[model samples]
Target: MKSPLAAIPGAAILTLFLALVLALGSGFARAHEGHSHGDEAPAAPVATAPRGASSSSALELVAVARNGALTVFIDRHDTNEPVTDAVVRAEMPDGAATAEAMPDGSYRLDAHWSERPGEHEVLFEVARGGESEIFPVTLTVEAGAAPGPAGGFAAWSAGLAVAHDFRRHIAEADPLPLLIGGSGFVLGIAATLLMRGRGRGPALAVLVTATVLLAGNAALGAETPTPPGAFLAAAPAPSQDLARRMADGSVFVPKPTQRVLTVRTLVTASDMLGRTSELPGRIIADPNGSGVVQSSVGGRLSPPPSGLFPRLGSRVEKGEVLAYVTPPVQAVDMSDMRQRQGELDQQIAIVERRVERFRKLAPGGAVSLVQLDEAQAELKGLTDRRTALDNIRLQPEALTAPVSGVIAEANAVAGQMASPGVQVFQIVDPARLWVEALSFNARVGTRDATARLADGQVLRLRYMGAGLADRSQAVPIQFAVENPPSELRTGQFVTVLATTEASQQGLALPRTSVVRGSNGQSIVYEHTAPEQFQPRQVQVEPLDAARVLVVFGIGPGKRVVTQGAELLNQIR
Candidate 1:
């Protein structure tokens, strides 16, 4: 048996196609016979509502008309924070309508008039505290249609269905109805031939030509021709509703959002940045300004007459008695002292009686007068020895401050036995502090230096001397802090920034400005535009205690984010 397509000759197929085209054209011409070309436009998408925007130097306002009402979102001109507690009034054609504040920091106006399609002007009067702004907005509300499906095929079907509706409406200046019907008929016939084992190659050509004609007709009926200068002036870019990460791997933050995030930028300058090598250092007391109070002999620790030991950070003057160490006597030493005291007391009593007898004899002229004088001298010597023995038991060693400064360390406690040469208190003049930094390479002629604390506090430094002895395979460099601030403690850790002979040219930025990207690369955010921030991968080197040098990936004279950069990276 022959194929079904073979029954129909090629000439018959050509004649049928021509008849179909003629019939479609005649139907379009007859339907639009009496109609004018100036008919109204088709209704707009039903899912979309009209929205208008107005901005001033102090505020930005967006008004959306939805479900016969207008919702207004008022934000600061600089910051995106929703404005609240502002007396807002909108002037309508009938009268002024005051907007009611909503809980989401927006205002709403009952605008049933917005449902009808028309061009209207609304004047917004906003007053907040001492600031007031007038935003005149022009809004155009258009008739909308229900939203269509989300696929290309679904859109084509929807276009065909709308074309079918136009068959009864116009079908005249609009060729969409004939294009839809002719394309569908050609596709159906081609599909029937393929299912009946016809030629696949010919069927494909037919489908392609029909699809091309369909698209061309749609474009010709819908799109209008434009002049060469039509694109000279471009439309303004729409404001971004939210901060997001762009597909190019850059963060897009609006200017208002940038202000809300408190983002700050610094201009990059190309200069000779001092090459620095980070070294672990610590805060130490100046040698000439610090002193240690220690005991000379082993004795028990005792408080001063003021009855309290000097506390840590206690201010003390030179020769101020911080504490007293009472010498503890052994059993044998106590026995020897008691024996000396008794003998001295007995000798003094005997000499006193002899002196009195001598004086009496001298007055009576029975003995020589020189013997009486000798006896009186012997009594005086015995009495002096007796007094010296009593003093040895009561005297204690006094521990006094050797320098006028604050006590940085205290170890003395009441009744505790303190060994000789043991430091009881450390008195350091806080006005002068020193920093000892260790460097692997010895810096001989280095002078300019700085020390940064962990809390970002910087201190000026003057070059002292570097130690000749190698400690931990590194040389120690000391720096005297110029104009040291209060609350500097000894042995506190600090980062020393010493300028070496080497120099580099780059932009210096705070350490906080750099952040680690998801790819584990060192990235710095550049404020590329007023409302856009782009992450720049950079090769960063240590510049100083608080700043780092960005050598590559970014050029000078660019505005780089110096503050709130990390927060900006967290968006999206």
Candidate 2:
């Protein structure tokens, strides 16, 4: 049972492999010029919009065309401020037209030439405050560049064109046609299967199935009605003027909307700034300017002569009576006082009788002068003790403010029993507030400091002192607010930035410039163009109350968006 392939000999097998190699090489050498073989240069960035940018010594202008209309945005060259009161004239090859002022500070013109897709030169003349400047802008519109995916007729047409080119190459190419190369490759595979002498039928069947699928796809591509050449000449439809995020993660904001958002930029410059550390802090009352009113002994509380307790936020002066605490006497103490008073009365009566007897006896030479003096002294001492006990039951202790400030806390209630050393009211001076911060590093410098509120309000602070005691693994540092705002309250949270003597060189940007990105990285928006903002991830450190030091990911002399960066990041 000799097989047919075994009889063909080894020379024939080697010849078949040589044919397969030649067929593959020739097929690649004659590949279509449109298809790349991994040696083509990278394509340029696709034009999303037809726009022209021009700048002068005093002004910067951008003109964008959409739907046969041109919108011109003019800004100051130095400050980036929008120019609203400028007379704009547009000169094109077709005709010259005056651009009408829009409510959004942009100029609009009816440009019929913009409908044609090609490069066009437009001259923009801007006049304001008796000065005029002419700027030439070259606008290029890409031909047949669609924004999204192609489907239906366009996709089918693309497939058909590829099939057509393939068929033409197989018919007319010189060295070896792709059809011949594929047939040779199949034959080589069949020969290898025959030499193995097993499962030949199934291998042939699988190859037959792959061939059928290729043929069916080619037939379907030929049946499509769209012509092969129409795909390259298609034009993109007009889109709306809106802010959107580009594919590269940059945001495209129209100039008119930038004004509404109040976008502002700062030109970054590298300089040495004081290094700062952000500490968790809270607002506290100044110790020297604050006080607490407390009862010295257990007693009942009573209102002052004005008849009302000083309420919270009520301003009080130093030594002003806030409340009264009357010490209630127990029954036993009262009984003891009565007993003592009776004893004192009996003693005084006896002493007075003795003193009168001494005076009479002295006149009869029966008593010395020293005896009369001693009896009078004993009578006087007993009367004084009796009077002091009466006054103790009548008088009440008056509670006065220790310092001039507003009553920040109040616990005074008339007839309420108060304990000894209980704080009745707390007073704080709003103008003399202090921020207490906890610094993890014991060596945190206090050369300068500031406090930033939750609402982005910054307060200048003067270094007071730091405690030597460790609390929660951190030292407590105190800073007195200079010219504190009236809205500040005790216990409000604040971020305290304590500046050290060490200096670091970096670009300083406002705290508002940085925003949290989608991936939780800190990013800043750079005003790379008039309306285009690019997000640059940056490494920053605390610089001061209102600014941060950008140490990396951005260089100096770049215009970064200082205001509305958070709003810019919202565009997606």
Candidate 3:
């Protein structure tokens, strides 16, 4: 009762399987890279939210439409500061509506016309700071276009279903895969029947299973319209207007994101500004308010009467004794001193005996009164010299502070040998710091100068003087800090911007506003639209510590981002 397929060789079945696999692979390869076989093209990039922008000489206005509502943003044209209390009224084709000010510094209007898909002219009348202005903007609304796709598991599953359908369509369009699959299916069924021999029940079950599988695949591959109720309800999702970089190298930031980033802007304006030069400098102690403790002669360092040398950062007043320097006497010098002492002693003893003899003889008229007086004076002089020599050997030099300040440096140690003219301690007044900068130019202005620290802190400086001599091919200029902070330390590096007598006309912008572009050019972000920022390459020059002069590339009346520009550049 064995069927004819039961006698077929196993090698023949394997050969058919390999042929089927090769055919399907070749079909997939062609579909993947050769051409498109599906009806739907790949989805286009998601568009930004609909918006309109308009600006005038004094104010800038922008409107964004979302959820059947239109939100308007207004700011000052000069400073780019948000205008919170402005009254905004919009006149549209259907009707007129007044906008309510929101806490987020935006005006919201309930515009029923925004839901309709068409171009609408909007006249916005804004009044703030006792001034009123009218701005006209054209807004376009697309019909049946979702702001963005839904989120969560529903969206993910929907995306997977779409991909599956697209793959099925490609398989259907290519006939090679279908032909191979059908031939493989027939061969597999015939082999199963041949192996079953006389078992009719099992053979019938296999036929039914194979038929069901083939029908299921056919159903999945076919195109069918889905009912609206088939899908779960669209859940509440966050807005899709996110901050991203555009293809044109611009950045698109939504209003909400801007608020979170605390982005601020400034309207650039050109004016005649004084020229300035930047110089490398460092903080130094003021000459009049700083002091150095040193030994005039080689000596041993000892603590003051308080029994301790001043530690670093110790505060001391002027004339406060800090330490004592005991000069070491060499053996030869000691011997010489002893010899001088002995000689003085002998002289004093001899002079005393002579003076006594003269005094005693004066009364008998054998010696004159003037001679006795002179002999006594010689004895007094020898005694004074002997006493002074002994005092000099025992005395120690007391070192005191010359100015009131904190000890910035300390090299003193008890019983430590100190060389002459060697600095033992350095005292600096924290409140009286000076910045020394190397300036190549001679005619630097003495009126305005500033020092910028690494942490972006700026200190006002008063010009002291510039050295006539050249140092490192530059003149050394000294400037006294007007009000230095306590955290300032001597030897800390800084950038000194000193004003010059020359003047130039340019737009001055904050240093943070300028950033380096991908191409290595200096660029600044301009608020071109309500939620869009464009990069403008600019050439800059030194103006002051906090600002730079823009020579060109951007003109006046454009809003330039000041704060949060670095954050804006990171968008991708």
Off by over 4 Å in 2: 1-50, 66-69, 77-79, 85-101, 109-120, 127-133, 140-239, 346-387, 468-473
Clashes of 3: 0
- Cα lDDT tens digits for candidate 2, 412-437: 88899999998999999999999999
Candidate 2 residue-wise lDDT at 83: 92
lDDT of each: 0.75, 0.81, 0.80
Backbone collision tally, model 1: 4
- Which pairs, if any, clash in model 1? 44-144, 44-145, 45-145, 46-145
Off by over 4 Å in 1: 1-240, 346-385, 485-487
Task: Rank candidates, TM-score, best first.
Answer: 3, 2, 1
Ranking by lDDT: 2, 3, 1
Q: Model 3, residue 78: what's the lDDT?
A: 57
TM-score of 2: 0.69
Per-candidate TM-scores read: 0.58, 0.69, 0.74
